[model samples]
Target: MRNKKQRIAAMCAVLAKNPNKLYSLNYFQEMFSAAKSSISEDAAVIKQAFEDVGIGRIETVAGAHGGIRYIPSMPQAARVLLLKELTEKMTDTSRILPGGYMYIADLFCTPYYVDGMAQIMAEWFVGARADFIVTVETKGIPLAMSVARILNLPLAIARRESKLTDGSVFSINYLSGSSRRLQTMSLSKRMIREGTRALVIDDFIAGGGTVKAICDMLGEFMIEVVGIAAAIVNRYPQKKRISGYRAIFELEELSETKIEISAC
Candidate 1:
């Protein structure tokens, strides 16, 4: 018999990892070996916790695939609160590096903070009423998945290099921050229907090439792009100010080795 908080945490964990998955109460029944009624109680507690915290959503689907799924949702307060926290952490000077880049990746991966970051970005997508979440290959998948879960939409990744995917969209391009030659790519034309209002997300943004390409690709489908979110924005020689919404702007480079941070 798990205690109140423990039970709620456990159930919430399941839903967080498996958002958009139709979970069965029966699955919870077997996993915890508690009475169905008791599991029901735990679920209700966890569901409301999810909503009250503005982390995401809790939905019931009725039957199979019909348990508790954490769907993405928007509540303004949650986003504001999280951005504040991000700003605070970035205040530490040690987080900065040379060449006007900031080091907040460690904090981003921290189990202590990643969840909060994930929730806020998800809310941004929801607030924009975006149809789905989009990001370039690598580094941004975590944030994308979090928001995708919140929105109950799909998480589509653009590959840096072509994979086994038969129909892929490929663009030869120079990365924004790093002039190093790179490939900006995605799945075939068959994938990614036209006219999706995608919310672009990333771990950080120094140069805007990837974002620009993502916007351009979305254009192919006649999809409207709502906006973009990053865990941190390192304002280097090139300032990145996207339209419609100002970024949370979590971090900045004071010098090659020094950094500064601000919250939303």
Candidate 2:
């Protein structure tokens, strides 16, 4: 049997996973079959626990759209510490490519590091009050999923072509990476509700062209862009930052060899 404190902690964690939804006390009560007063008191305990941890916050909103929201409140000290750690890992030449770009794929998929990156990005987004996560197909999905899990929200993928997403809607073409070939991408317009709050992300950024196209479509839905992030970035490709967005890695061409990296 779960103790009251344990139950409370679990409840808070659930709400923390997804702070945007309206979770009624009735819902909790029914799940636990506890009284309303007991559930409310448990919530209080959970609230205090979050405060002590100092990563994020929980707030209760009332009526229709009313529910608790977990706001990640990272102090400057924490951000500095995290950045220091991330930079240290980034500095290792072993992770660097001969082409000048740091090959941090191993680091990105690492349990601990990806969790750290997710927290750093989550804290940043929660602070900015972002609501949705957006990304293109393939590599970006996993990272986006991590962020969405922390935020407890849904992710929108701009597909390369019409997938079996059901009820096909629309498609767009944009230059992919450094290639001259125009590639088609898609999204079920119905899948996206109006006024979505998007925080765009990618696995690699060589130019702002793809990001811009994604943003342009988001504009049609009147969504607000929270920010942007990338696992790696090739800075010299376009020599232009997509004004108002921030990238995580600044890539350089170090060495290009056809060395077969060991498969995971």
Q: Pick the candidate with the highest TM-score.
A: 2
* Segments in model 1 whose C-alpha atoms lie over 4 Å from true places: 1-17, 20-91, 127-131, 164-167, 172-187, 236-242
lDDT of each: 0.66, 0.69
For candidate 2, give the lDDT: 0.69
Please write out the lDDT profile of model 1 over residues 88-126, one tens digit for every residue. 667666776666555666665665466667666655555
The per-residue C-alpha lDDT of model 2 at residue 213 equals: 81
Question: What local lDDT score does residue 29 receive in model 1, on the 0 to 100 scale?
Answer: 78
- TM-scores for all candidates? 0.65, 0.74
Alpha carbon lDDT at 85, candidate 1: 67
How much does candidate 1 score in TM-score?
0.65
* Residue-level lDDT tens digits of model 2 in 1-264: 267977787787778666445588778888887887898787677778778877566677777655556665555676577666666666665675654445666666776666556666676676566677888887667787787777777888888777675366567777755665798878787667787688887776777778878887888789888788776666557664376666555554445432222100
Each candidate structure's count of clashing pairs: 22, 10
Stretches > 4 Å off in candidate 2? 1-3, 16-21, 64-69, 72-82, 98-102, 127-131, 164-169, 176-181, 220-224, 231-241, 249-264
